[model samples]
Target: MLTITLAQADGSWENPEQIRGAVAAFVKAHLPGNAAQAHVAVQGPAPGLRFPACRQMRMGFFGYSNPYGNQTVAVTCTTPSAWTIYIPVQLVMNQAVVVAARPLGAGTLLAADDLSIIRRNASNLAGSAVVDPQLAVGQVLRFGVAAGQPILASMLDAPEVVHAGQEITLIAEGDGVRISTIAKAMENGRPGQTILVRNSSSGKVIRGTVDQAGAVLVPF
Candidate 1:
C-alpha cells in the first residue's frame, strides 16, 4: 500500500485522527476501487491548520516520484467550514516527476476529458468542510493558486441559445437606426453576419445582421 503522509504546512495539528478519518471517508465516497493504495500517516503538532485545514488525500495509483522522490498531493481546506478544495493534479504530477528516471511531464491545456486525472491530485485540507469528488477523464477544468479558489470544469460543450422577443443589436444597419429587433430561433447568428430573427409576439421573421456582441438587429 502507498503511504500518504498528512502534515501541516505551518506545522500544527488540532486533531490528527479526525483528519485521518475525513481523508478515509472522502476516498471511500469518491474512489472506491483505489482504497488499498492509501495508507495515511499523520505527523505534526496539535492544533494544526490555522487559516485552513489540510488532509492527505489519495486514490488510484499512489506512486508519485521525482528528484524530490515520491510525494502525494494533500487536499487543503482554506477555512474550517468552507466546502471546496483546490485539486492540483497536473501541477503536482509535473513537479513530482520533473527529474525522475521517467518524468510525468506537463500535460496539454485542461479540456473536456481530464476529470479523473485530478481525483487524487490535491494537497492539504483534511478536517475542513471541503469534500473532494472523483473527477472524470478528458473533462475540461480550470485552476489557480490562492486558498479557497474555485476550479471550473465542464463535460459537454453547449451552444448559445437565444429567446424570442428580446431586443438585440444588429450588425447590418442599412439606414442607421442601430437595427434593433426581436428574435426567435435566430440566436445562432454569427458575429458580423446576417440572420433571420422571428418575432415571438408577431411571428414575423425579419432579416438582420449580428453585431459584435452577437445580437441580431433589425430596423423597422
Candidate 2:
C-alpha cells in the first residue's frame, strides 16, 4: 500500500508552501500510474494568506470528479476547530501522445512520416487526443494543425474511398439470398458511410453502406 505524509504541516497556522505541497501530494497520490507525474498548480488568491489552522490538515476533492484537468479541491482541517477552504487546482500530468511532425494543412492525409509520438503535459492537451499512430494513418485532417501539436480526434476525418460516378460492385442481401451487380456511385463516401448508388441494370438510386473494398452493401 502506498501512503504519504507531509511533515511540519499541523494545523496550528496555515503555511503557504505546505498547502501547495499537500495538494501536490494529493495529485500525485491520486494519479493512475507511475508513468505520469502529477504537478498540482493551486491557482487564485494569495498563497501566503494566513488562516486559522486546525489540528490536522487533510486533502479532499471539491466534488465527485476525478482529480484531473482544471479542478477544485478542498483543503480542510479535520480535527478540533474544523475549517475548510476550497482551492482551484490544475493537474499538469505528463503522458505520451501523438503529435504532428510538421505543419499540416487542412484536408491533408495522415502518413507515417507526418506523425511522431511525444510526451507532453496532459493538461495542455485539449479535449481528447489520438494515442496510436495506426488510428490516425490514412485519415484526412479537417483543420490545419501546428507542428508538434497533439493530434486530436476532432481534427481528423475519414477519407472517402468511393467517389461519385465511380463504378463498384453492389451487394444486396435479403431473404437469406445474396446478389452482386456492377453499379455507379451517385455520391462520394468513405468506408462504412451510407451513400446513394445507382443500379446499372434499372438505373434506380438506392442507399447503401460503402465497404473498404469499394463495394456497396444494401439490405433489402
Candidate 3:
C-alpha cells in the first residue's frame, strides 16, 4: 500500500488542506447533472484556531447540503474524541434557464416569442426556475412577471381551454371507432382538466376533459 504523507503545521497539528480535499470529494460525488458547473468553497479554520489533531478526521453536514449555497460543515476528530468544529462553505452553481422576454400580466399566455434562454447564477433564484422554454411557453402566468425575469414553475399554469356554460363538441371513441356529440360545459377547465358537461342530445351530464380545440373527450 502506498502511504501518502500530508504536510502538517510545525508542532501544532492542523491539516486544513485535508479537510478541504474531503469536502471537495464529497461535493463532487453528490453534484447532479453534466450541464452545470459545480464548485465547493471551503476555507481552513483561522490560524489561531486551536484543537487537538486526530489521526482520523471525519467531515459531516448539519443537514442535507444543497448542491448550491452556503452550508455549515462539521469537522470532527473520531480517534482522539477531543474537539469538533464547524466550517462555513459556499457552493456556487451556474446553469442555464428560461427567462421572460417581455413584461407579462397575470393570465397572460406565454408564447415562444415571450421567452428567452440565458446562463445565470441560480443561487438567488427559486427552486422552480424553468429550465426549458417548452415548459414555459403555452402556459398562463399565475402572477405578473417582469421582463428578463426568470420564469418559475409556480408562476405558470395551463390556461383555461373550456369555459363554463360554453357549448363544446364532445367526442367519444371506443375500440378503434369514434363518435361525436354536442355538450355544454358546466365549468371552466384547461386542456387536461376534467369537468362536467351536459349532453345536448341525451340531456345528461357527463365527465370529460377539455381538449385543445374547445372540445371535450369522454371515454365510455
Best by lDDT: 2
Candidate 2 deviant stretches above 4 angstroms: 1-22, 29-36, 42-45, 54-68, 76-79, 174-177
lDDT per residue for candidate 1 within 102-176, as digits (tens), equals 211233233332221223323332211112222322322222322223232322112223334455543335555
TM-score of each: 0.22, 0.73, 0.76
In model 3, which regions exceed 4 Å deviation?
1-10, 34-36, 43-47, 169-180, 211-220
Backbone clashes in model 1: 33
Candidate 2 overall lDDT versus native: 0.79
Which residue pairs in model 2 clash with each other? none
Reference-based lDDT, each prediction: 0.37, 0.79, 0.76
Task: Give the alpha carbon lDDT tens digit for every residue of 1-220 in model 3.
Answer: 1112334434556566666676666555656675246667776676677775556666667676665566767777665445677777776667788988989899988899999998877766656678899998889999898988999899988889899999999999888888998899999999888999999999999999888777999887
Top candidate (TM-score) = 3
Who is ahead in TM-score, 2 or 3? 3
Model 2: worst 10 consecutive residues (lDDT sum): 1-10
